[model samples]
Target: MKNWLRTTLVTLFGFSLLSGLLAGCSRDHHADWSADDVAKVRDRIAGKMDLDAAQTQKLDALIAQLQVLRSDIKGTSNDPRAGFATLITGDTFDRNGAQKLLDEKTSALQQDGPQVITALADFYDSLNPDQQRKLRQKLERHKSWFGH
Candidate 1:
């Protein structure tokens, strides 16, 4: 009985550790994007691109539009991991429920993603060829920073 108890306790401890690690891994670090965060992003991009007054204004407008769309989408979105805890805790596996959650996320993306892409495309088209080259080079350098 003592050996059985010890084995059960060890198994429980292992399960607890696994669940904790899974929960931590599932967290979204960039889930919340506030206006202040958007401003910081704009400033960083502007600094890298050396945007003039007109480009700065356009970029600022694009950032504002994106922030508004993000807010709208976030307001209507559910917790992405709502049912994940149950799965981690050894509850009945609901594959359909998990698929539904993914579908909801995809639908949300489809709703707002097109507008963002269009805005970014417009901004990119507005850049001069030299500015475009500089931006491309800067992006390539960032790939190296990520160990790519």
Candidate 2:
């Protein structure tokens, strides 16, 4: 009986350690972009660009690709916000938790920003010079409201 208890304890301990390690590994690879959010952004971009059917389809695909990549990145990245969603259901706010979440977000943004920039470049490069200029203006005007 004692041996069985010891074995069960050891198994539980092993599972706990394994879970923690997997959690950390996951933080390094996730990106959080929901489908609805992706569709909305694509619609906005398409509208601003006055994209033709071909351009719209291409843009939609790009947005979908980016969204999926973002979700993957969020999964692998460590951001305090990972736990923030639960805060809404809980009774109190944990300032330390909030700070950690913010820190994670800042770190994630720093690490993943270049990838987003590269993707933007790909999209921009596909546009004609006139369209590019217009796109730039639109982006500049909305920059404040974006990335929030």
How accurate locally is residue 7 in candidate 2, as Cα lDDT from 0 to 100? 100
What's each prediction's clash count?
0, 20
Please give, for residues 1-148, the per-residue lDDT of candidate 2 as tens digits: 6999999999889957965765655453324546776678778878877776767766765665566455544555356345755544557656777687668657767676766667666676678788889977877888973523
Query: For each candidate, what TM-score against the reference?
Result: 0.62, 0.44
Best by lDDT: 1
**Residue 126 of model 1: what lDDT?**
80
- Give the Cα error of residue 59 in candidate 2, in Å: 1.4
Off by over 4 Å in 1: 1-27, 30-34, 68-80, 87-90, 144-148
TM-score of 1: 0.62
Residues 1-148, candidate 1: write the lDDT tens digits. 6999999999999978976875675565657766688778888988888888888887876776676566554555356455565554555656776687567657767888887787777788888898899988877878852433
